[model samples]
Target: MKRCFLWTLTLLVSVVLVVPTQAQEEKFIKRKVAIGRFTNETQYAKGLFYDKENDPMQKQAMDILSSKLAASGKFILLERDDLDVLMAEAGENMQKIGADYIILGSITEFGRKTEGQQKVFSSTKTQTVEAGVSIRLVEASTGLIIYSDEAKGFAETTTKQSLGLGGAAGFDATLSDKAISSALGQLVENIIDKCVDKPWRSYVLSIDDGTYIISGGASQGIAASDSFVVYAKGKTVTNPQTGIKIELPGKKIGTVTVLQTLGDTPETEISLCSYEGEPLDSNKLSNYYISDK
Candidate 1:
C-alpha cells in the first residue's frame, strides 16, 4: 500500500509540473494594421502592356506581405484597398474602426539577367531575378512616419545540357515572385517588432449604465479582470522649423478593469470595463485611451 501511495504522489507531482498555470501562459495582444499602398516603382514589367491600376508585380508584393502578417497572427489587418467602398457601405460605424498604423511601400528595384557558359561537350544556362522593396510605417493618429526600411531578395535557376541533349532553359517568370516574396519575408519581422514596440492601447467606445465599453476584447488579449491604465491625450504643438505637429506626453488619469467582452470578430470586438480612480469626463472620452502599462 505504501508503494502505491508513493506512485500516486509521483504521478500527481508530474501532472502538476506538466500543466501550465494561467499566469505562466504567454500573452499576445493584437494591433490593427492597414496596408495603405504598395506600388511598383521599378522599370521592369513597365511598357505599353503594363496597367498602372492593376500592376501584377505590385499586387504580388502586397499579397506576399499581407500573407506574412496574417500568418504571424499578431495583428488585425484592416482592408485599405477598398476602404472607400467600406466607408460607403458601413456608414458612420466604419469610421470608428481605424488602423493603429499604416504601411506604405514600393518595389524600388527589380531586374533580371541571363548568363550562359559554352564548353566543347556541355553547356549551362542560368536565369536570375532580383527585387528590392522599401516600406514606411506611419502612425495613423499623428500622421507621422515612425519607421522606414528596405530589403532585397535574389533568386536564380540553372540548367545544364550535355551535348545539347538536355531540355533548353527559358525565361523563368516565377523567379520574380520568388525574389519579391523573399525580400518581403525579411521585412515582416522588423515590421512586427516596430508595431509592438509600445504598449498595447485601446480607447473608450461608450458608456452604458456606468459600464465602460472599450475598443478591444478577447481577440486582442483583453480578458476579464485585466487591469488597464487610462491616460489623457497629450497636448499637440507645432514645430516652427519643420512645421510638424507633435504631441507631448499624456497624464495618467485612472484605471479600468475588464468585466466582460463583446463581438465575434477582432474588428468588431469590444470590452466592458469598470472604471476606478479619477473621475472621467464622459463627453471628453475621445481624449483618453487605455494602455496595458
Candidate 2:
C-alpha cells in the first residue's frame, strides 16, 4: 500500500507539471507573413531601379525596413519569390496558409540636395536626402486593410564645403550621412509600430468550467495575463427579404484569463472566468477578439 501511494503521488505531480507546460507553450506563437515585393510608387521611377545600379544606399534602406520588422519578433518574412511559389501551390486557397496577416509597401521618393550659406567671415554648406515610403497591413484571409501609414525624412551631409570666407561651395559628407541614418531609423520605427498596433480578430474554441480556449497563441503575440470578454447568443429575428432566420445581437458572456499555451496550432486553450456582462454568441465572438500585438 505504501509503495502504491508513493507511485500515485509521483504520477500526479508529473501530470500537473506536464499539463501546464503544454498549455503555456500554446499561448503565443510567431505568425508567418509574406511581405510582397515593395513596389516603387514614385512616378517615373522604374521597379527595382535602385537595385539596378547596385546602389548601397537603396540596399541600406531595404535592409533597414526588413531588419526593423524582424526585430519585432512577431512575423516570419517570406521572400518575394517564395510568396509567388506559395500562391501558385495553394491557388485560391493561398490565403488559408495559416498566416494571420500580410504587409505591403512602396518607396515613393528618395532624393538628395545640397545648399550653401555665406557670411562675411564664414560659410556653411548642407547636403540632405529625403525619403518617402508608404506601408499597409492587411488580413491574409479577408484582404482587409487594417492599418496604413506613410513616413518621410531628410538626411544631411557631414562635411561643409567652403569656397571663400563669405562663400561655401562644397558638400558635407558626414552631415549627409547623419541625416540619412536618422530618417531611415524613424521610417523603420514607424513601420514596426503600425504592424504591432493594428486590431486583429481571433476565435474562441471552447470554455470548460472557468477556462476558455482561444485559437491564437505565441504566433499571434498572445501572452499570459491577457484578458478577453466573452460573448453568447442573443436574440433572433427574421430576414425581411429572404424570410430567413437571423441573429439580432450577441450578449456579453464573461471575461477570460490566459492561463496557459499549447503551441501554434489552430486551436489553443485559455482560462475562462465569469463577468458581469452578458455572454456573447458565435456571431458576436467572430467580431470581438483580435490577435495583434
Candidate 3:
C-alpha cells in the first residue's frame, strides 16, 4: 500500500508539470502591430529640405530618425506606397489593417552644425544645427491619442584639424553624423517607452452617482460579492530615460461591491465614501479598471 501511494503521488506531480507546459505552449501568441507613414513636416517654404543631394545635413537627420524608430521593435513598419494603397481602399481607417495601435509622427525640424570660441590671439567660429520632432500613438478602434511627445536635437562641429598636402586630418562630418544619430535614437526610445501597453484583467466602469458597471463575470471566472478597487483612466507622461511612457498615478475613485452579473458583464454599484472627500469628477469618468486584489 505504501509503494502504491508513493507511486500515485509521483504520478500526480508529473501530470501537473506536463499539463502546465502543454497549456503554456498553447497560450503563447504574438501580438500584431502596424506602423503608418511618417509625415515629413521638416520642409520650410523651400521644397524638400532634407534630401541628401540637395541638403546633405537634413538628409542625414531624417535618415537617423527613421532608422531609430524602425529599430524600436514596437511595430511592423509599412512602406509608404503600401500604406497609401491600404488607405485608398480603407479610407484612412486604421481598423482595416487589424492593428492594435498606430504610430503617427512628423519631423517638424532638423539641422546640424558646430559653434564655439577659439583663441589663436582672438578668433572664434561656431556652426550648429537644431532639429525637432513630434510623435503620437492612437488606438486603432477609438482613435484616442494614448501617447504623445516632442524631442529636440542640436549638433555642432567637433574637429580642430584640417587636411593639407599629405598631413593627417580628422573631419567634423563624422562627429555631426554621430550626434544626429544619438539624438534621434534617444527620441525613439522615449516614444516607445511611453507608449507601451498596460493590460488590466478586471475593470469597474462607474459614474459619480454611485452607479457602476463591472466586467469579468462568471463566464470570465468572477463571482458575486467580489470586491474590487475602482480607478479612472488618467493622463500619460513620458519618461526621459526609457523613452517609454506610462499612465499617471490614478485616483482611487471608490470601492465597489458586485451586486449581480449577467453573462460576461457584471452590473455592480459603487460607493464614493471610500475615496477621499466626494466622488471623482463626473466629467472625467470616461473609463475605469478593477484591481486583482
Candidate 4:
C-alpha cells in the first residue's frame, strides 16, 4: 500500500509540472504612441544664446524618452514632429494611422554645477547635472488628458588630482545625457502602466467580400485563430454642470476569429476576422468595436 501511495504522489507531481508547460503564454499587445510636443521651459532657455524655434534641450528629452520606449518592445512609436504638415498631407486618412495616446512634455528644470576643493598637494573637482521632466498622456480618441507626472534625474562625476598628476575633467557634457536618461527612466514604467491600464481596443475598418477588416495585425501581437469579443458602444450623456459627455458601459454583442493579416508595416497593417454569430449591420459600424476576451 505504501509503495502504491508513493507512486501516486510522484504522478501527481509530474502532472503538476507538465500542466504548466502545456499552458499557453499570454500575448503582449503593442500600443501605438506618439510624442506630440516637447518644449523647454527651463531657466536655461532664458540664456542669451537660447533659441525658441530650435531648442536642443527639448529635442534631447524627447529622444531619451523615445529610446527607452522603443527598447521596451511594447509600443509602436509614431512621429508627430511636423504634426501640421502630417495632418495636411493625410487629411481624414490620419484616423487610420493615428496613435492611441499622445505625450506632451516639457523640460521644467535644468542646471549644472562644478565644485573644486583645493589643498596643498591635492585637489578634487566634481561636476553634477540635474534635469526635470514633465509629461502628459492624452487619449487620441477623446482628446482628453489621462495621466500626468514629473520626474527628476541627476548625474555627477568626480576627478581627483594628487600633486597635479591626475586627469582633469572638462565641462562633462555627457552628464547632461545621463541625467536626462535617468529622469526619463524613472517615468517610463509609470507611463507604460497608465497607457495599458485599460484593455486594448480596435475597430472594424470595412467589410470586403464577407471578410471583416479590422485595425491591427501580427506586428501588434495579434495572431491567426485568436478570438476577440465584439462590443457595441453605450449611450452618451452630457453632464449638466461639467458639460462633459460621458459614455455608458458597452454591451457584448458577439465574437470574431482572426482569419489572416494584411499590410507590410504596423502603420498600415490590418487584420481579417470572421464574425462568429449573426451578421452585424454594416452601416452601423461606427457603434461597434473589438477588445480582448
- Candidate 1: which stretches are off by over 4 Å? 1-23, 84-97
- Colliding residue pairs in candidate 1: none
The lowest-lDDT stretch of 10 consecutive residues in candidate 2 is 266-275
Which candidate number has the best lDDT? Answer: 1
Best by TM-score: 4
User: In order, what lDDT does every prediction score?
Assistant: 0.84, 0.57, 0.52, 0.83
Clash number for candidate 3: 19
Q: Choose 2 or 4, whichever is better by lDDT.
A: 4
- For model 1 the local lDDT of residue 215 reads 87
Better of 1 and 4 by lDDT: 1
Q: What is the lDDT of candidate 1?
A: 0.84
**Ten contiguous residues with the weakest lDDT in model 1:** 88-97
**Candidate 4 regions with alpha-carbon error over 4 angstroms:** 22-24, 43-53, 84-97
Error of 3 at 74 (Å): 4.9
TM-score of each: 0.85, 0.48, 0.44, 0.89
lDDT tens readout by residue for model 3, 233-291: 56777779976556576656666666666652222222222233335555554455445
lDDT of 2 by residue, 10-115 (tens): 9999998999788876533455566654565544334555554344444455565667677877665655546546645765344544455666666667776777
Model 1 agreement with the true structure over 1-293: per-residue lDDT tens digits: 99999999999998888778655775667888878568899878688888888999989998888899989988888766675454356443333437777788999999999999999999999999999999998766666788899999999999999977996888788999999999998889989998888677788988889999998888677799988899998998999999988879789988999999999877788999999878888888888888877
**Least accurate stretch of 10 residues (summed lDDT) in model 4?**
88-97
Q: Model 1, 212: alpha-carbon shift in Å?
A: 0.4
